[model samples]
Target: MEKREVVVSITDNGPGISEDIQSRIFDPFFTTKPIGKGTGLGMSISYQIVTEVHNGSIQCISQPNQGTTFNIKLPQKYNRVIPQ
Candidate 1:
């Protein structure tokens, strides 16, 4: 069977993220927000859902002062095993 994928892109016009911080954006408990303002689990959870659950991929592209874009690609069809 031929493999197919669905691509999604989210972009923001706000100041883009720095390279140093982008590397860890998907790490659990890694957030740029101030203390008590954010838990930093959002991205980590999203990454897990896309990559593990759906067999997809997620990436972040940005440049300082330019903008930020998140690209997600999910397989159109995936196989899941059911255990009795």
Candidate 2:
């Protein structure tokens, strides 16, 4: 069967993420913000929803001082039931 997907791209011109931190951005409880300023669950939850619930993919592309981009691809049609 041919795979069909919808792509979403988000970009930011602000200072981009460093290579060291990029790999862990989607990890639960991982954040670079000050202790009281962030819960660190945003990205982790986003990753899970896209990959698990939607059966899709997400990727981050960044270069320090240049910019950052996030690309998400979701299947055009999904048949599986969401987890409880």
What's the TM-score of each model vs. the native? Answer: 0.88, 0.89
Q: How displaced is residue 24 in candidate 1, in Å?
A: 0.4
Using alpha carbons, what is the TM-score of model 1? 0.88
| Model 2: per-residue Cα lDDT over 4-59, one tens digit each | 89899999998999999999999999999999999999999999999999999999
Q: Global lDDT for candidate 1?
A: 0.95
Overall lDDT per candidate, in order of appearance = 0.95, 0.95
After superposition, the stretches of candidate 2 with alpha carbons farther than 4 Å from their true spots are 78-84
Alpha-carbon error at 69 in model 1, in Å? 0.6
Question: How badly does each model clash, as a count of residue pairs?
Answer: 0, 0
Q: Model 2 TM-score? A: 0.89
